[model samples]
Target: MKVINTKIADVKIIEPSVFGDERGFFMETWNQKNFELLVSGKPTLFVQDNHSKSKKGILRGLHYQTKSTQGKLVRVIVGEVFDVAIDMREKSATFGQWVGVYLSANNKRQLWVPEGFAHGFYVTSDEAEFVYKCTDFYDPDSEISILWDDPSINIKWPLIGDPILSKKDENAIYLSDAPKLSL
Candidate 1:
């Protein structure tokens, strides 16, 4: 696997080594030892795995849990999407800043969003299947959503029209008003 650093040091873009032949292709998606070496250099356990599918124009986040605070390793499995991560750690140098990347089944790239960051994505294809491994269990009551188009963060979403947002996301508060991670 190869790791590429994003503007926010805690976030990373991972490219796994793919081996292909006339038949098809194979890539080791995860290996605890290898992943640990790349990140914290300590045991990192993914306690949960999640998968979601969305149609084009669907925008699903800028969300994080104030309590469970998950660190995620996410990727696209069926189509393409522009994934984003915002640093919500109050004391970090890159606090309130964000990074965006195009993740597609064709590219097979994955992104690492550490704890204390808000994550979201915009579908760029007809449809997309997104999946991720999270270090913590979901805590719906603790989940906080920040406005996808919050002016303070000013995320440059690659959109052709207004995105289709869930009611929760539509009503999300701006970064200035949202609760941030104290870490």
Candidate 2:
């Protein structure tokens, strides 16, 4: 796998090696050693895996958990999406800044969002399937969603009008009022 770094410090776009034959194709989705070689500091242990499906124009987040419990590797499987990561690390130079990338089945690109960022995505195709691995299990109480359209951060969502959102996301805190990270 080849890792591509983004302008933001901890985000990356990973391209996996795919071998295709007459019948089909194959690729290793996740290999511990290869991942370690590309990413300098990440826990080898990932406790939970999650997947979700969304239709075009659906926006899922600007979300993150509290520190020590923050980090996820996400990718698109069946369709295309504009994946995003926003730095929330209080001490980082890019704090409150965001980055976006297009991920799809054809590209087979993966996104690595480190512990101090809020991550989200917007489905750009008729339908999209997304999957991700988290170093820590889901903790609803600990999960926090910063408003996807928070003017303070001003995410340039590639949408015409209002994008579909979950009730929880619609009620997410705006960046100005978001819980600050102590670490």
Query: Quick one: best lDDT, which candidate?
Result: 1
What tens digits encode model 1's per-residue C-alpha lDDT throughout 72-143?
Answer: 999999999999999999888999999999999999999999899999999999999999999999999999
- Candidate 2, which ten residues in sequence have the lowest lDDT sum? 36-45
lDDT of 2 by residue, 85-161 (tens): 99887888888999999999989999988777889999989999999998777778888899988888887778957
Residue 108, model 2: Cα distance from true site in angstroms: 0.3
Provide the global lDDT of candidate 2 against the true structure. Answer: 0.85
Q: How many clashes in candidate 1?
A: 0
Alpha-carbon runs more than 4 Å astray in model 2: none
**Residue 183 Cα positional deviation in candidate 1, in Å, after optimal superposition:** 1.5
